[model samples]
Target: MRLPKLLLFIVLFCFVFLSGAQIQAQETNEKADAKQAEPPSSVKELKPVTTIDPLVPLDQLRIMVRPLTKDELQVEANAWFELLRNKSRQIAAARLGVKKTNEAIATNDDQQALDSLKKAESVQHMADEKARQTEEELTKQAQETLGVDVAVDAARPDPAKAEEGTTASTEEKSATTADSTSTPDNPTTTQSAEAMKAAFLQNINRLQDERTALSDRLEVVLTSLAAKGGDVETYRKYIAAVSGLELDTSDASAAWSGIKGWFVSKEGGQRMGWNLGKFLLILFLTWVVARIGSTVISWLLERKVRLTQLAENLISGTIRNVIYLVGFAVALTALEVDMTPVLAAIGATGLVVGLALQGTLSNFASGLMILINRPFDVGDVVTAGGVTGTVKQMNLVSTNFRTFDNQTIHVPNNSIWNGVITNITANKVRRVDLEFCIGYSDDFEQAEQIIRDVLADQELVLREPEAVVVTHALADSSVNIVCRPWAKTTDWWAVKTAVTREVKRRFDQAGISIPFPQQDIHVYSTDASKGNGKIETVSK
Candidate 1:
């Protein structure tokens, strides 16, 4: 009985211990689950409000603004103004966050402060990205509503002006507030597009003023924070991010007024007039110098160099044009005009023009080659570019040809250069080749002698080289003779015609017949009754 009681007590003690351990394990699991469910204290504490309050999200604002009618744009402009105000607040909040984080770090020397600083920086980065996106969308909207140039000009902030003011002047503040109040609440209200654009521009100006003020405030805060041994680098980066949001407004009328005032002012007008006079004087001097230089070059080329007319003209004209260009550039410099952009533009234009005129350039290059190599010149008879003609004119792009029939042809220099060039009158003398045919029965020796006699009788034919008369070929009907005579290039045609006529006359007198083409045909007929075939031959 004592042993049973002891066993029962042991079992009860073991069961109680096991149940207690189980309960403790359950409580530990619940605690782990609760810890996992909650976000880190640092992350929760530093989560930035990413939205611009009292205005739709940037994406929603884009949708709302995109399809708005011209009259409706004014109403939306108010919302945009409100959006800008909220953005200014957001920037202020971010600035405050940085100050607070810095203050906390200064006061607390612990890991928690470091973690908070890191989280705060992360949050600030996120805020900056959102602000950038919002600014871009607003800029795009403005650009779409107004002309791109006008919007860009209006939005382009003047750094000098921005640096001058930390806060808007009382008058400027009142004007901005007044402009914001002028925007109509009703979307159905009729308003001119111009008026709406003016209002939008006014809002953009307000936004710029607010941003300048914020930047000034941030500058002070950053300076103070830096004095307190806080992280100023992060604040500086924030300032830079905000500075990128340029949304200033400039009045066209004010710009025009200023320009008019400058022109009307005696000192300004006189200075401008003086510059103009200087530019004109420089240009005139340049023109006079260019003229004198060109004349000198022409005289030198003609007298000293004694180049061909084309080469002389090309050189003189090129020098004259270069002089003119240099003079123009000098004139511009005298006027204090920037030449960098001009030169860049000219270089770009030259590249495009060169690409477009590749064939013309090729012709020009070929023409230069022709001039340098002296292949053919004006008045020379040439067989080139598949055309036989006298070269009437030559230029960089093309060569003019006058055919024997008196038809003028314009041949590209490239075409003439790329092919075989036969300059008939390039040399002082040329050879005239003539072929004559005689009957097969006629004596070949007699025909050859006749051709030689004809060539000798022609006064224009050259004798030093001696003429050639030989049996060239024997055809079925005739014997062919080749007569080659050398003569002055100028008298070549006359010599050829005279020799040919004399040879024909001599052949006719000597009874050497120039036979026509002949053929012999044979026909066969079969006699059926006799079983024989009769063959007949006919000559034609």
Candidate 2:
């Protein structure tokens, strides 16, 4: 009886505990629902945060939200406009931050300056990104709402337009509303859309200009901070970050924008112009110095050295070209152009050209050898490369020759150098050989004497080397007398022709017969009628 009474008491205690726990759980759920249904106490709490002061932490920068659907765009257009205005404000704040950083740097507050600069750079980047997002959203909205493709006309959104649109009076809003509610055929809606496109383009231009100005100012501050011996690595990171955020435009617009920015930004345009002017001045000075150097070298070569014309020209021209090349490199350096890539490209091009022009290169090398060896000079009569002519001109690849019969020939230097070269006018004197045929019956001594007299009468012939007149050969019908006369190289042709004409006239007057070849033929005929044929000779 005691155990049954105890079990009933425990069961009652368990039921009361379970009921109490259930009532408490219901009360807690009811309170939670009531709290969930309560509204915020202030309207300002509903607005997105837009305070991007220089003192604000970078992580707390505002994150702009773009509406993704047509209904959402309609509901959120005003909010987006406010966000765009916030972005513009952020840009302005970044500008202010840069100015403050500059001041801090001036005060030698390195840490503070670096922190401020970093914050400004971060804000600028965020603002730039938000501006791009706003532009994209505007394009999307235009396409979704008005069925107008602004991208087809290369119309882009302007960040400034957001501020302007947000600040517009109520009357403008009412007018825009009236235009939007009009029928599709109404010209006012079309006009509104067109005006919006123009505004977008104009705003984009303004935004780009403002970004350029801010970027330029920031660059100046960074430069000043670096000059002050601040933390370089930190500022360098800022520089890299800022560089990445530069506004990008279409190719045509970008070019035009750059030109406009160049003129608009005093530091950039003036600095570049100064650099360009210095580059040109240095180049001009280099050219002057190079010219003077070449002239001096030419004078020294002409007065102090006896070199071939080709060698002289080659040396002077090479020196001049090297000077010009160095000057050009220096000019490029003045303009802050990097030369490593230029030199690498030049070396690569030289190698490729060398490979493609093997035969031409062989000629060039041969020409250098010829210049060094002093084989021949301009105006010297040469017999080389299977041709005999006077050297007219020469270059690294080929030599020009004017033939005795008035024909121009271009001979590769390789051909001339690889073969035996005969320079007729290399020496002051040359020998002319002449052969005359006479009858064997005539006195050889008289013929020899006549030839000697002709050589003696020629004023151009040289007497120191003496002339030679000898019987060279005994032919079938005559004797061949050889005449060798030495003369100045310049008079070689004149002496030879005069001596030949004089010898012929003397021979005719001296009755020394010049022989001609003659032949006699004999034929025998037999009479067919005679049984014992007697051979008879017939002469005609």
Candidate 3:
């Protein structure tokens, strides 16, 4: 046993020495390769085309001072795309390295496996740096050739040049119309316009081609990365540059070096652990405080402040929710989650949601208005937004009401706010105004007295206001009487209904006539024998 242990120790020491030597040799070779493959000076060259000379004739300028050719732009774009391909290639190589590392581990070659992973990471880093420099080259080329920060196809044409073209065309048309014998036309202008159009189209096509190629390569790399999803150096090779090609990195969980990295990385492991501990402590504290805060709020509302149940619930719930959100934000920051981008994203998302849901936003605003104004409370019988119903539940977006038929109706707050709101039970007392028609011959005074008696006799009617019955109008067939009485708001409907029934009964009992609708037609006929007209009455 002593001899075997001694041999194992010697073997381990030799393996460690060999691995260090191998790593140092690999690094030297990589540096040499990097130095040899340095990018050409032309790649970094820039000749910024500041402002276009609108006065220069397109054809003349083509023959005179030299300008950058379209091929140069294509070469620059190709260079940039080549860098993208190389990046994908690096990731692919790293993936192979990961496989080799795994194989080494399965074969009990631990040092080889660790070395492989380290090499892969180093290669990925070098590749990323190269890609970054290449991106700079791409941007510089765009600035020099396009004379702007963005690509050529995205830039608008010069307004001055457009105006010049229009002016030239007008002059040409004027010349042709004035004289037919003049030089038919100069084809140079047509050539110039066509050339410009062709150039613009060519640039657009080239940009699209480059973008498509980059997108395809990015897709392939991403797909491979997804398939090889695990805690390996290969998976994270192209992680940082995924956004440029518009690939979503949210699902790149395995590339986070497993769950521990979801919070913080191993390089900052101690600090991360401390922060995580604090985060949990803060969360626990927040939860305890939130419960206490909610209880205190409810107690204040019920005992000290005095508010309705709904109002208290709304206030306490809102306060607790706000505290919860603030606590979560603090915890997230402690966990090393970037809050600035999170906040910006939230703001931008809010703007988009607001624009998309304009009607909904209006409803929310109106609900706030309704809450503040207190026009009508829940259970109030009201005519709102063209619907008459008893308000059941009033919320932020909509108000639910129960119609007379017991059917539920939901009204948007915006409509209710914009339209008229008539709360039937708004006042403590309400007046019931009713008009009754009596026949011309029957006895108007008696009918008025009967109406007053009916109103006064009603149980729900308020005696303090005193009921009034007056002759309103005397029509061709009847005398109209107005009966107005006051009652408690809750019993107004019942009193009005009862008064109507009682008035008709008392009038009939008192032999006072309530006339039905009638019309009298007069007919005139010519009598041939007497040669005179005779008139007769026809009642309807």
Candidate 4:
């Protein structure tokens, strides 16, 4: 009985001990697991204290073993012992002897400066490691965040649909507000909802602004095109041409097909055809009108006129230009163009061009004056603008003259209009002024009679003016005489030549001497009184 009781007590003791030991073991395991779940404090520990927050982020820990304070050294020794318990751990550690030597320096009792520098260096290293870890973690998080935002932006709704929806929402909101205002009981609720609606419709206001701007620009472009001769039919034809282009639509059939069909309609074709027909008609009418106008102008110019060739050319040019101008204006009107602005623009351009060509305008005006006044007709010999020549032709800018030497001269009309003009051929008869000189030793009366006889013999010499020869000047060797004779203007040169030749020949025959320039001189030599030198005599 004693043995059995002892055995039962032993079994109960073993069972109780085993159960307590198992419970203790389980508690220890749970504590180890808790520590393993946590992140490291100083990174020297074999396991961390809590699991890290992946989203919050943490960088990898860096550790450096070095000297510590005496108190911290004891803690480090204990920590090393603990590390030994987990000997399988691979971690950097300073030897105890080396740590003690370094810790003595760190305590700095006799070497305080060295110890302070060591402490500062350790602190700085720790701070730098922490900053690097934080920076790395932030970079990783920033990359992930950026990628997410990109995905979100790419998935955002299309702007066109958003604009349409926003517009509809605004209209609904306006209607709802009007309804709410009609019912007074829901005023507060309506105001709150209206504020929310206003916030939501901000994008709608912006879209509407853009749409208004686009519409205004479209109107401007349309007006410009129309003013410059673009029409609805032109637009329709352009659309038709673009639509007829063949496109491979396997990848995008629906969208392109709808676009193509919209432009290739029967209305578009008819519009283009009508425009083409109208263009051809306008062109034909223009040609016919131009031909008829030119013919009429030519006929008018061909009519009898007292004007010269140059004047006739000027008049005909002016008439043809006027006719073409009128025709152009009429054609533009027929084409349904608004000509008011066009005329205004043309007037402005003309004003600018006229100002720029002021000198040319003056020349043209002077040419016109020359044509109208008839100062000298063509084929008349005139002296004007320092030039003596026969008039050839007068153009808008210059007058042409053929000089006696067979040289052609272009004189500006401005000079001709503002200078003296001498028309030598204005009358049927002209004077032939002559001068003659005879020797003082000769008989003046005889020389006079000889000139009169010479003039009387010439057939083309005129007697109406009554040629008179008289003694005009007395000189050292000769007496000068003036001869005046009237002659037909056409035979002036011939008559003058004949009379001069005859008078000289008759004087020679009649013994009326015409002396050359003569001089007489007396000379006395100073040496003649002394009878030392002989005087030289000279004769010619």
Candidate 5:
């Protein structure tokens, strides 16, 4: 050993000396070349060294073919580096082309959005035009049936003797109509004229009342539009549209006064009129009631004596949601809004989505069932759908579990309901099972006593059921000893771990052998071992 060590140190010293000489020779040569170099005016030609052999395998041979100079090696390294850089640039250019194609595809998406916007605008314009035409036809029919033109002509008498002729003519016509009514079977033309005149008079009065109400409503609408800084023509159409509504007001004077001042007042008022105002008020009241109702429900749930955490969550989420939905429906009806269109839209959307996600809907329905039934709560250790873990959270489609090994798993609710659920922590008490084998040469009683002692040492091990040690099986080489101890569910792991450690440690100290499978072989020498039994040629 000493000789080998000395030889290694000698070889290392020679290598260091040769390397140092090479470095010194190179440095001297560089200094001499620098001293002989002329002034910077002349350009020096750079000639690349041609050849340098790469490192060869060390096991081949100890002798080297003339080693290349440093300049030659540097030239070769530069040439190989340039080739690699060129290859990398080519690869980068290919990647850039792919990126440009992706940019073009993204730009094409804007055209789709623009097309949708244009379609929506066109639909809105068409609906507006159709509503306008329908309102105009209704107004025209009401005007033609009411005899409004005849009523207006009758209201004004001739310029000369207007008051005297109006009173006398009205009395004479009434008297004539009353006499003609006595002979009902033979009604004359004058009677018919009087009847027609009375019918026209009643119809004219009704039309005048409708026109007055419409005028007041129009004024209110015009005031609102003007306040909003709408264009003159926009205000005119708004007034005309409202006039067609034929709104009836009890106090015309008060209504017009309210409308005129509403435009000047700081407070926004009668410009919206009673219809819109009542609608907004109903909506606000509904929201407030819903909020208060939700708060009261939360209070009630909190006050309950046997309220579970899950029930509390359900009351706030599910029950409160139902209340809000009903409240909104009631508010919409109170405002006299047509809910049919909205309902139809909602039904169509639901139909499409339900058809698309049949599996997801099934899981959601199963999840609701699980929540209502509550087979297991959070932190319950369960094995379901081929997975074992503690329940972390329950969602609409799936349940999340955090396994003992710290892996997060998502189990579908449908699978949980369809598969077997083994809840280990459902019971308060659990039994620990243990088994060990001892060599046949070891005393059975000693092994049993050791296992019992190990069980007794663990404080978490329960004493009520008592620990048991039995000779479960007898094998060819060993006797199997089975030990059982009862413990609380929470203390199962602690007792199990403590007993296992103590059993191993005490067994080693007591010289008790834990047996494992082994094989034995017998060898016979041809010359020696055959003398005892081979005299009769008997081999067992």
Candidate 6:
């Protein structure tokens, strides 16, 4: 009995000991999990935590009060919003972290609870901060777009929302009340739920008044500057800068300075010579590249591309322009030169020139259309603009023409495009037409046969289309016959001239008298007193 009892007691002791060990193992795992947990990469985790806020790049930055295009103003607004959002996040995270740290100590280093609370707290903080910043940005952008001080919806922070996050220990709650009196950077004047809203409204109103006064003054100053010439516009911009606006002050002076700055302002003028050398090198390279690109484009068009001559030329010209423009832009940027003013000047000059040469520009446009449409090309005999001439050269603005009288005429493209164009030499083959007249008494068949024989004998005339001599009409004294022959365009005139000469000669040899204008007349003589007249027909 004693042995059985001892065995049973040992079994019970082992079971209790194993169960306690299992419980201790579970507790250790829970502690490990708590320690392993960590916060995510938040806005605070960014580098250089204590440095000044990241402002927008100088090239992109614009004054808050300045006039800007829609796209530009949007970029500016987005930049400010980014900066503000980042700044607000960092502050909120820090404040919440402090609240968590003090609460963790109050809970006697309850690490597992603290970690869960931290995760919830940080997420909530980020969301709230984002919503707040977005509201502010929207309000500011609205006012800017309206170009006036529009009403802004106030940003009111709810205390219940901020403090309603994770539950804290009793000790943590007491501390929260004392710490919540302080804001992110400024202490709250009042403990109301809308304290933030009140403060923000007050600040915005002050800013609105200041900006309005400056804008009003600026308008008046600009009006005065418009009347006073000679760099008064430049002065106006500088004044705008003083009034907290960014006006583009890039003028001739700025342009020159920018150019000079490229060469002389690098490394305390250490690379002055090198910079100048680079400028010259870039120019030389640009010329070489432009020539090479032009040659390559021309070769491609000649061999591989199946476009028309005019299209080929246009493509080649455009490619070369691009090469030069790009190469120069790169070189200029390397030297730190700004081309804004130069480009502006060019645009302004072009506008003036275009307005002055309206007719010429019209001709140019019409000429381009003609070239594209290909109504007629060089060496074609075309009747255009009420003048018939052979095209000598077809230029972009006009067509050079050589008239039959050996006079050169330049017909503007406008006149030709608007007129009917007849291309006489467009066909490879042409018809030579000739007419002959013979006495009505002459055998019409014989006369026709004689003309056909003349045309058949002409070597320059074509035989496939066939030559024909047909009696055309019976006139008062003659039978009009037409002799038609076909010939190559180059041989048309020669064939016609030869056929005409031969026909006349053959008719004479055959005794077929060519008609001369003659009439058979009748003369009647009678004594009036006799009241009788004898009529006689006379041939004259």
Q: Provide the overall lDDT of each model, using Cα atoms, as 2-decimal numbers.
A: 0.62, 0.63, 0.61, 0.54, 0.55, 0.58
State the lDDT of candidate 6 residue by residue for 424-462, as single tens digits. Answer: 888999988788899878898988888877777778889
- Candidate 4 — which residues are off by over 4 angstroms? 1-348, 511-540
Model 3's alpha-carbon lDDT is 0.61
As a TM-score, model 4 comes out at 0.41
lDDT of 4 at 301: 54
Candidates 2 and 4 compared by TM-score, better number: 2
For model 4, how does the per-residue alpha-carbon lDDT over 1-540 read when each residue is reduced to its tens digit?
A: 999999999999999999999999999999999999764565443321111211121121111112222233333223222222221111011111122223333342423322332343343234333433433343344345334322223564533344345434534544454454444354433342334323322332332233222222222333334444444344323323422223324324323533343344333334345655665666567667666765566566557555665576556666656666775666555544457678789888998999998887888999888888877877889998889999887778888899999999998888888899898987889888887777767789888888988888888888798888889889776788899888887888887888888887898898777776776544556775677755555432
Q: Who wins the TM-score comparison?
A: 2
The TM-scores of all predictions, comma-separated, are 0.44, 0.52, 0.46, 0.41, 0.43, 0.43
RMSD of each: 21.4, 22.3, 32.9, 38.8, 39.9, 25.4
Question: Least lDDT summed over 10 consecutive residues: which range in candidate 2?
Answer: 48-57
Poorest 10 consecutive residues of model 1 by lDDT? Answer: 47-56
lDDT score, candidate 1: 0.62
Model 4 clashing-pair count: 6
lDDT of 5: 0.55
> How big is the positional error of residue 280 in model 4, measured in Å on the Cα after superposition?
16
How well does candidate 3 score on lDDT at residue 179?
44
- Choose 2 or 6, whichever is better by lDDT: 2
lDDT, candidate 3, 1-540, per-residue tens: 999999999999999999999999999999999977875567445432312221223344333223334333334224434555554544443334334334433443334433443453344345445644555565565466765664234364532233234334433532432343233353433333233323222222222233334544333333333334312233224434432222114324223332333234322355568889999998998898888999999999889877655466667867888899999999998885647568878988998888999999899899888877778876788999989999887667888899999999999999999999999988899999899988888888778777877876778988888878899798877889988899999888898889989888888898888788899999999999999999999999
Off by over 4 Å in 1: 1-310, 324-344, 528-533
How good is model 2 by TM-score? 0.52
Give candidate 4's whole-model lDDT.
0.54
